[model samples]
Target: MSETIYERLGGEDAIAAVVDRFYERLLEDDRVAHFFEDVDMRRQRAHQTQFLSSVAGGPVEYSGEDMQSAHDHLDITPSDFDVIATHLAETLVEFEVEEADRAAVMEAVAGYEDDVVTVAAD
Candidate 1:
């Protein structure tokens, strides 16, 4: 069988590093920082790391809220989602993830957009 993206990306440690950098970029971006204002970043970072690990086919399990329920009250817009996705992609690039792996990750993230963005319901 082919290597899982998690394995290809160096597993949990690498996923944690990417998630850390991703949040750093998100926090620095005024456009997306507001969403995290009330968040406990340490816990948020841990959730994200595990979430990404699972998405990449790692051993970790995501015990956090489901995507839609998690962001339903946040009123996230398509543009906001795009900015976040860009940060994620950039974070992957910063970590030197292979093109295919990066693309795969972004694609997986994109699949959650409808569940994440709630602008129309606002």
Candidate 2:
């Protein structure tokens, strides 16, 4: 059997690093950083790690709220989602993950777009 993306991504520890960097980038970006203004980053990082781990086919189980319900209150727009996705993709690149593996991870996360971007584009 082919190696899972999680294995290819160096498992849980690596994913944690990715999440850390991703959040750093997110917080630095003024366009979307406000969404995290009141958020507890430590817990958010853990939740994100589990989410990406699941998306990467890892053994981690995501017990956080579902994407739609979790994000519904945030009124996330499509552009905000795209910016976050870009941050994630760039994070993967910075980590030197292979293109195909990055694509797979993005694809998995993209599936939740509808569930996440509740606010329509302007």
Assess every candidate by TM-score.
0.95, 0.98
Candidate 1 per-residue lDDT, tens place, 1-122, comes to: 99999999998988888888899999999999999999999999999999999989998888999999999999999999999999999889888999999998899999999999999632
Off by over 4 Å in 1: none
- Each candidate: what lDDT? 0.92, 0.95
lDDT: worst 10-residue window of model 1 = 113-122
Q: After superposition, how far is residue 44 of candidate 2 from its true place, in Å?
A: 0.3
Instruction: Return the TM-score for candidate 1, rounded to 2 decimals.
Output: 0.95
Tens-place lDDT digits, model 2, residues 22-122: 99999999999999999999999999999999989999889999988999999899999999999999999999999999999999999999999989895
